[model samples]
Target: MSVLMSAFATLVGGLADLLQPLFHAGSAAAAIILFTACVRLAVHPLSRAAARGQKARTKLAPQIAELRKKHGKDPERMQKALMELHAKENVSPLAGCLPSLAQIPAFFLMYHLFSSREIGGEPNELLGHSLFAAPLGHRWADALTGDGVFTGAGLVYVALFAIVAAVATFSFRMTKRQMAAAPTPAAPEGPDGRPLPGMGAMAKVMPLMSFGTLLTVAVVPLAAGLYMVTSTTWAAVERYFLYREMWAAGAAPKASGAARGAGGAEAA
Candidate 1:
């Protein structure tokens, strides 16, 4: 673990050194963004795989729901049937998890890099870098309460928080769109005749989980916050392009068939 941390810190430090001359005092902050972007790009294949899994599940949703409705009374049967359906579709419930799961190690490396006062058993100089007047290693809360509150560092944190808020908003809207487009399962009824937990509602609520990022950014080193901002923004844009391609590709067949039908009608 120590060896890995040392190696990662060295890599990040080297990257920062290269970037240091480009920025005024925010070179570390810029370095964090660059480093994060590089890591995210390296994991692009995992993101693509995860996106494919999500697309598969979305396409198979109707059939899965039918299985659920058919076996609603028997939990064990429903589970087995769902498993069979997934197998047939070549989709795994864990498909959407791969991209995120793959990121855990990178996240830990960033966390340790920011949290540790020393890296590779030497004096850590990254902390000496700042975004504006705020040190990259300084926490938002510490900056707000200390003399930094009166300086440009305070504004830096405020700007970061704003970016996080924007990301959360975009995330919520994307999730809501996904939930709206997803096929809803036939919900079971309770004894009172009220419908039980609706899958649609659960899906919509899941996006709210993103708000936690704001809280996380508030307490971490500013460098990590910068990392989160750049990484998440990149993810949002990447998903947009990927989904656009998927939608266009999926629509092509239907579009061609519709065009042929119209031509036939015109001929007739």
Candidate 2:
């Protein structure tokens, strides 16, 4: 583990050196952002695969709904049928999670790198870096206690908060729009066709999950906060484009089906 930490520290230091000319004192902070972008790029293929899997699931909704209806009285049977269907269709139930899960290690590395005072028995020089007036090793609480939110480090945190809010809002809207357009068929329904028990409440709360990043950025070291912001922003933009492509692709089939139905009606 120490070996890996040492290597990651080396990578970030190299990036900081490369960015020093452009970012000056904040080069290390800039390096964190660049490193995050590289990580995202590496996991992009998994993201694309996840997108395809989501499209497949959307297409399978009707079949899944039928399975649910057929086995509604037996929860275990319904689950087994659902699993079988996904396997038969070559779609993974957890595919959408791949990109996010793949990023956890990188974020953890950044957090520990900045949080540590020593790395491999030597002083950790990266902790001395700052993003503008904010120390990369410091948290928002430290900024608050020192400068009280209107000066220097506090102002840097305020800026970070504002950017996070804007990005989170955008992500929230995008997710809500996607949910409306292609809702999951997995929401259990009671006999009267109402959403069963807590399902409706769960649906309502899911979109707001994006804003949870604000709390994360507030508590973690600034270096990790930078990673969170860059990653969340990238995810929002990537989801928008990918879902748009899915919608376009889905539309073509529906249009052809409609045309075929009209032709049959005229012939009849």
Candidate 3:
């Protein structure tokens, strides 16, 4: 863990050194943003794959619904049919999760890289840096409690909070739009053909994840907060462009013959 964090901090410090001319001492914050952008770009191929997979699943949702209708009574058979359908379409249930899963390690590394007082077994000088008036190493809690809420440093934290909130709002809207477009899962139905209990509730709650993100920003070191804001904002915009490009080009997978045959047989 120490070796990996040492390497990670080295990379960030190197980037900070590179950008020092432009930002002066504030370059540490800018470096975190740039490093995050590089990470985002590096993981983009996985993001593209995940996007393609999600779009394919959306395209195949109807056939999946049919399979569920046919095999609804037997959980084992339904699972088997679902797997067969996915195999035919060349999709994985986990495809949409690939980029996110891939990013977890790096994300935690950045968090620790900024949050720690030591790196490479030495006192971390990077923490001495500040962005605007806010110290990169200072948590929002520290700024509020120590500096008082109206002080310059405390206000800097507030401004960061605001930026994060705005990004979170935009993210929430985009997520809600996508969820609205998603075909409802082919699960057991409740009265009046309604979706089963908790489905609607789950949909409503998912958008609030953005607020959860805001909560994270409120406690983390300013450097990590900067990372969160930059990465999430990048993710929202990246997903938008990728989804449009893939959809405009008609890249979503079409149902294979086996899936169509199964659905047709059930229909008849």
- Among these predictions, the greatest TM-score belongs to 2
Error of 2 at 213 (Å): 0.9
**Candidate 2 TM-score to native:** 0.85
Model 1 residue runs over 4 Å out of place are 148-150, 186-204, 245-268
Q: Which stretches of candidate 2 lie over 4 Å from their true place?
A: 74-77, 186-200, 246-268
Pairs in clash, predicted candidate 2: none
**Candidate 3 to truth, TM:** 0.83
What stretches of model 3 exceed 4 Å from their correct place?
Answer: 186-200, 244-268
Which of candidates 2 and 3 reaches a greater lDDT? 2
lDDT by residue (tens digit), candidate 2, 25-109: 9999999999999999999999989988988978887887787678877877777787788889999867888999999999999
lDDT of 3 by residue, 53-158 (tens): 8888878878877876787777777778777777999988777777778777877887898788888779998988898778888888888778777796888877
Q: Tell how far residue 132 is off in model 3, in angstroms.
A: 1.4
> What is the lDDT for 133 in model 1?
78
**Who is ahead in TM-score, 1 or 3?**
3
For model 3, give the 10-residue run with minimal summed lDDT. 185-194
What tens-digit string does per-residue lDDT give for candidate 1 at 166-225? 988887777665544444433433322224677546654688977778888888888787
TM-scores, in order shown? Answer: 0.80, 0.85, 0.83
Error of 1 at 148 (Å): 5.1
